[model samples]
Target: MRRSGPAVEQLIGALIPRPLPRPIPTPAPLPNLPPPRAPTGPNRIELDVARLVRAGRCSARTLLHQLDWRPEHRLVVDVADGTILIQRHPGGRVLTDPRGALTLPAAPRQLCGICGGDRIVLAADLTRDRMTVYPMTVVVRLLAEHHARLADGRRGR
Candidate 1:
């Protein structure tokens, strides 16, 4: 039987040199930086989600109020990039209802693939005085893209 006695330990210690203790490192100081500036632009947008009612009507009273839209206000409804854009136009044929509910035109709604009872995103651009409606399909695509970018460790648009 082999025994690991002090004699064996002494032999091992003679074969290996003991290492010196390492000094703890001090952390470096943080660099002085300027304060973050306030966001400045004419593209400040407010976002809301609402369900489209029957007859292509959707309730967006808060967004409309933010854009300063009032009853009888003329609005132009159009579709761009599969999203519905409602803008205040002097020659617009559509009018805001008395109760501030928006009656989206059937043509534009169809173009954006929006249907009654569908969930929609209302993005109101305060400076532009316009509201953009994104159907569920568009919203899903956007969210998918955003998540994909995040997974890839990249910034989302």
Candidate 2:
């Protein structure tokens, strides 16, 4: 007829709403980035290309179409470690099977590399582009958070 221990706490819990956890915050830039370089030739093109990839507002096909370029135009995405090269040649897309054999998919995206909206472009693309993944700032923030978690984990009542 009466509950006054764990059961009582659980009963009260069922009636209360819990707050959702906060998302990770964006980290500030590292102390130094070279003064804005003059945007010209490959430099200008690369800058615009990176901005487009980062914005991710338009489809890759549409993005490529809007640019005044042909199959000859090659674009590279830079990251912390390496680059990703993008070629526009046709019959260039190859699908793979579970057994690691060359295969074909019913429908393959022409620009699957930049398909992800927020996450960094795939690592394979990074190497092909001959660019490096700029992750030191993100790494520092993550490590700081990780160490804070370690301290919290060791705390005792």
Candidate 3:
């Protein structure tokens, strides 16, 4: 028996291994970012804390543990119009969070006022003794500009 036509051709093609499609690259930064304030640095990594919440995985605790910081370390959270920055307090003090994440006065809003309904970016700076969090308007803006940058390039593409 001979197999032919488009349907049969498609069936045969399905059994062959094919190269995966390339990932869609991240979009460029906004025109309004400060020229000198690009997000770059070796200690940084981006994470979607809001999604972690919905996934039932406590990222706050996991992040703290990854940075080797204990509950006694101070937390510095700077909430601004377009960003929410969380870091170890410069002076360092005793603070604790029952849920094992940055203890905020309230859950930080993912929506950004400047971006108009867009989710804010959540990036972390992991260091020998502390972790810094920068929930910005765009992950690329902060991570790209910061010196010594490291991104999770493997998305299983």
For lDDT, the strongest prediction is: 1
Per-model TM against the reference: 0.71, 0.23, 0.38
Evaluated against the true structure, the overall lDDT of model 2 is: 0.35
For residues 69-123, write the lDDT of model 2, one tens digit per residue.
2333433322222223333333445312223211112122123233323233211
**How would you encode candidate 3's per-residue C-alpha lDDT over 61-139 as one tens digit per residue?**
6666666557677766555554555666756433645556454433443333222223333455654344333444456
- Residue 86's lDDT within candidate 1 is 88
The 10-residue segment with the lowest total lDDT in model 2: 100-109
Q: How many clashes (backbone N, Cα, C below 3 Å) per candidate?
A: 0, 19, 13
Runs off by more than 4 Å, candidate 3 = 1-41, 44-46, 51-59, 90-94, 106-121, 128-157
What TM-score does candidate 1 get on C-alpha atoms?
Answer: 0.71
Query: Which wins on TM-score, candidate 1 or candidate 2?
Result: 1
Which residue pairs in candidate 1 have backbone atoms (N, alpha carbon, C) closer than 3 angstroms, thus clashing? none
Locate the minimum summed-lDDT window of 10 residues in model 3. 111-120
RMSD of each: 7.1, 17.5, 16.0
Residue 137, candidate 1: Cα error in Å is 0.7
